[model samples]
Target: MSMYCNQCEQTAKGIACTTHGVCGKDPEVSALQDLLVHAVMGLSLYAVEGRKKGITDPEVDRFTVKAIFTTLTNVDFDPARFQNYINEAVAMRDKLKERVGVSFDHNSANFQPASDVAGLTEQGKQVSLDSDKETDADIQSMQQILLYGVKGVAAYADHAAILNQTDEKVYAFIQEAMAALTRNDLEANDWLGLILKCGEMNFRAMELLDAGNTGTYGHPTPTAVPLGHKKGKAIVVSGHDLKDLEELLKQTEGKGIYVYTHGEMLPTHGYPELKKYSHFYGHYGTAWQNQQKEFANFPGAILMTTNCIQKPQESYADNIFTTGLVGWPGVHHVDGHDYGPVIEKALAMPGFPSDEDNGTVNVGFARNAVIGVAPKVIEAVKGGAIKHFFLVGGCDGAKPGRNYYADLVEQAPKDTVILTLACGKFRFFDKDLGDIGGIPRLLDVGQCNDAYSAIQIALALANAFDCDVNELPLTLILSWYEQKAVAILLTLLHLGIKNIFIGPSLPAFITPNVLNVLVENYNLRPISTPEKDLEMILG
Candidate 1:
């Protein structure tokens, strides 16, 4: 095998992708990504030491998080970009090593890269996920879980830091966890403990991100966004960055160009600061998986602010631009602070030729909005007007068996409320689930970044009913696709959440022993059919 990647749900053959990634990542790029992760692990070794000495470099903290984020699925497939990141990671690691005045005997701490891309790629192969064939399969599974969870944390931490929300403890845990991966002394129990710790820290990371988003954009309010387009020059913004969307919205004002949200950006329409822009129109497509078709038909410039980028089809390849940490070779890259190029592209293109009222989807039922109407919600639940609550969302993917989510939502009883977040909601976002006692049954709780909001809503309901959250008539039916979903699952486990029904499939990385650990401790189960699971859950 020239390469190995199974970080996402659609890994080839329900196992690993050996030659190239199912997500279009080639072997050379995969090698560089592996090298980048190894380099960051070295830097983390010193960063962990620095924290013990009461010395922390904000630059190191920020770079460490951002570098780990780049290795996540579909974030970057550019070999040159990864090459540059590899060099930078080594330089940062050496600089921190000089300051810490400490040495480790481990290979991760002392490893040096050859100065060229080919050399680095070769070195990366030595440290690839399969390199450690001597370790126990269960321990290896735990390591993958830990590493992937940290990747998710870094993504959120980077997003939070962008909005000026920084927490040193979060950074500390990240460095410590990465550094721990280099240790050969830890046992299975030790790895399990660290795995749960990763989840606990993710909770903090998500909380900080929540504060950053709401503090910057104001709490999301329930808003209706159109599913159709209006006649105008247009730009469609995808991914999860509100700041980038805000910059574009600001630049496009009075320019006769309409700005639309795509994928997870749909929830940004509920933000007061963003929605004030008259031309910031509505959503344009479904989940990220469907973007190849959706983007081809979109007659406007597309700006992808974060991950979830598919290889652009030739038809719309020239019309798409990537900003922030997301990148693809040959695609134009924009600095997050500026939107002039994107605006120019939109102005040059022919946007919607006519107005189309394709109806609307309601979003922004975040923690604050839902909690604001707590009295009515409590009354409804107490009177049995709302029989149950279902939190059903995760990263949406291109794989089969995903229709199970749509079927589940469609089959859910009318008296139940569905709270969804992330791109997974695209499965049934347009369905008219109607309302229960004046409360809309289908509630959009912002992006996956806003998982914190969903947790708060569940907690608030539990408090009002004077029962533990597990005792409430609430069920978590989740679908996962990537590292972010893994991190969120760990967070749920850390919070002692049980009986979570997750599908279209379980992660390929989990060995049966590790699987049993989760099953025994958390009561985690795979989804059967929505009908069977709902019957079991309701019974």
Candidate 2:
């Protein structure tokens, strides 16, 4: 119930209905989801033991990630599907136990009858909030931190899995953190240490994903993407998968179909290998929150490769396809790195007319390619060609005040360059801000996890100037929606990075006292109106 659920950001205050979740998930389903998480934790522990014994297997890593992702917000909205995940996790845990010479106690199995929905609901109601009575606020904070940290790890693991990258250490840390969350004796500092460790592990997860992507495809390079529609059929690749887009691009090459990136996928245009494709078009709409309206009249099929999948409207339901961890009840799912079904659907859809035209979108400027221009960038800074650097990025949410991001971007000074990443760029990504000194003022680094790139660029700039990163004229204006952003934010904080502007609203899960510590120490401020915030930042 919302009253009890500290897990969700959107939990209802005082009472999340004992019978159902605010997100439409019933209480029985929520319990099952918890059980699934518990099972995954057990499996992760088994895998950790396996690795300690030098018994490595890819299935262990795969199952660990798969279980955590299944628990993501709105990913497994259907209770029936979530039950399947639970069963799979239990089975995987058993398999791992057997492999590692450990025996799982079958006596702990808590299975409910499929036909007894009402009975299951009653049982869910009887479920105690705590099986162990260690509810101190400090302990609660630590548990919450680790739980949220694992959620963020699951997100990064999902992204890496899409690129076929799996790291045992990353997976092990997730399991270890989850297990720690289940422990009652761990002190506050222990939890804090684990929370920081979670951030450190997430850094590795992001690095693994980055390596997987750039290694499989190629380092991203600057390229102009087409924003307008072309003649014939087209498929819009949304979410955050370059591999899927690349596969679809290859499949649709010369087939009279155009492929455009949407949301986080917009950065794919920067990849040299992916950009080499002639059929790959430019980005379409803004962020994930705008998808419902943007896809209303889209004359092409849409493929979602990861998160930020909103409930599809009927207008575009027939044309929307999902892959990897992204799933919507009735929407078609193309799993296992497969884009075959997606490609076929795109070909079948009635594409845009040859005579119809929209516009063009320019993307690219990832770290490797950006670093290639480092000497020039250094020269520009020396000559006063570039003044302030604004890292305007993070996640997109359904909150109303998010428009502040667009306003802030619009109000950014002419001499400043904006380095953005993740879905947050949707705020001002579609705007034509023009370029300065042969480089676009707005540069998309990559996904949220690619905050690493933003850090790299900032550190590089600081190194060039022989000063600490905080001393550089770089400001981090971030908007967060989910746990992944939480991990990234912690990573920034852990590095002693300060002067951050965070909004559209603070996380509901963060207590006032915890937030105060962040604000007092890190100088993190909520975003205000663009005019005022711009004045404050520039001054």
Candidate 3:
């Protein structure tokens, strides 16, 4: 069966993945994701009716959020697992149907899947992105945009949920938005508006996730983390979830296993509670794209807790462990916070031969961390000590063009201050960009969810400079990979932030017309070369 998946920035040749997903999602897995989306749409139809009756199911809401998140690129490659989620979704929808006193409409919202994998594959074939024969390419693009943006929202919300943080508003929007897709009356413009609304809702989801993180782990503060620490029985934990890392830390507390962070997990070192752990040491690897090589070379077990998981290499497959929403067919999965096997594997492996001393990278400049130094930054800006502020961050990938981000920061003028977050910062985190007096020129503002922190810092700068945020001497040079970047880009556009530079490539989901609308309304531009983009932003 043919497939069509272009949900990530790194889609094959910058277009839909037809035969096989570039992210290692084979035809079967791609079909399952389509089926899962169809199932969610089915559940949303009933959930919508249930909401009208003031009888919403929190469990259904959670399921809808997670089901969509699991279908995202590079997540949940196991078709068998997706089949379970789909059948479970049908049950949840029926339960809601009983509560709303609404009879089944026999629409996709109530349709059951076939009993076998072949049947599920047949069902999925009809639901691929290309199968929707809406002649208007722009409307088709907008629909894809909304679905992708919501997937990002679900991922962030799922992270917060694991921390015991749930926003009913977010869950409600997830189902309501999915239900909107089943209706044919909505036009391209309608879907476009909904996409922006998803962006706004995503802002709230990210805010809740941020609140959950700070509430549990305490606010992030500026902390220096080692980049090369290969000592002892090392276990490198990657992805963005801090809760899983904390649990691993607790279980390995006195076990003598060295717990190091990798990729997005690098920001966890800045949290007060997490940083308190003596063995919660340093970072390993770079971004999500380098996992095959990085994980292969690591001395011990690798645990991935969230999105941005690559197909594990056989070299490290035996030691790779997946948890939460992350999955790769044969890899070990840890559930119920049981790190017993992971610990056992780490302990059994030979420890790092010696500490390489690869120097250090600084992170944890979240809202509280940066805002405390706001007055000083404001003074620096007013005194002509700081020339411009460039927020260069987002999801990092393995694209060869991604080196532009590191070069952009490296080549910035002497007086400019660079603010960065998320895994993208890994490109230049090791580069020494000098400092303004005691303040570092490159400020690490935690993870991608901490984008709200970037917004707060931007607003504060605007207030200090006495201008609209767009009027301030700030530029957003972003590089996006997946749906989370879509949500953040929409948030920036929603706030009227202008002249933002985004690259390595634009999303394949956006049609030429929809792309024009964004460009005309927001002046959002794709990034050029480091030399060229820097000139445009600085000028």
Tell me the whole-model lDDT of each prediction, alpha carbons only.
0.91, 0.73, 0.86
Residues 1-539, model 3: lDDT tens digits? 67888999878888888888778898888887888888888888888787777877778888888899998767788778888988898788777777777774545766778999889888888876568786477777888888888898998889888888888888888887888877768887788778878888888888888889999999998999988775699899988888899899999998888899888888899999999999988888888888898888988988988787888888989999999878888889998889999999999999797878888888888888888988998888889999898999998887669989988898999899999998899888888888997789999998887888899889987887788999888999999988888888877876778888999999988888888998999998998898988877777
Model 2 stretches with alpha carbons more than 4 Å out: 1-31, 49-56, 98-134, 337-340
Residue runs of model 3 more than 4 Å from their true location after superposition: 103-106
lDDT of 2 by residue, 1-539 (tens): 42144454444552233445544455666665666666666666677678789877677677667777766665555556665666676677777678889643322222332344444333443332333354775466556656766787878877787777877778778877865554557776687778778878877778777888888878877776666767778788877767777778877888878887777887778887887888876677777767889988778888887666777899888888888666767888886657777667777878876654566656667888788888988888889988888899988766568788888888888888888888887777778877788878888788786777777788888888899988988889988766778778777777778989988776655556666767898888888888888788778
User: Which candidate wins on TM-score?
Assistant: 1
Q: Candidate 1, residues 289-337: lDDT per residue as tens digits?
A: 8899999999989999878899999999999999989999999999746
| lDDT of residue 285 for candidate 2 | 79
Give the local distance difference test score of model 2. Answer: 0.73
Looking at model 3, which ten-residue stretch has the lowest summed lDDT? 102-111
Task: Rank candidates by lDDT, best first.
Answer: 1, 3, 2
lDDT of 1 at 351: 86
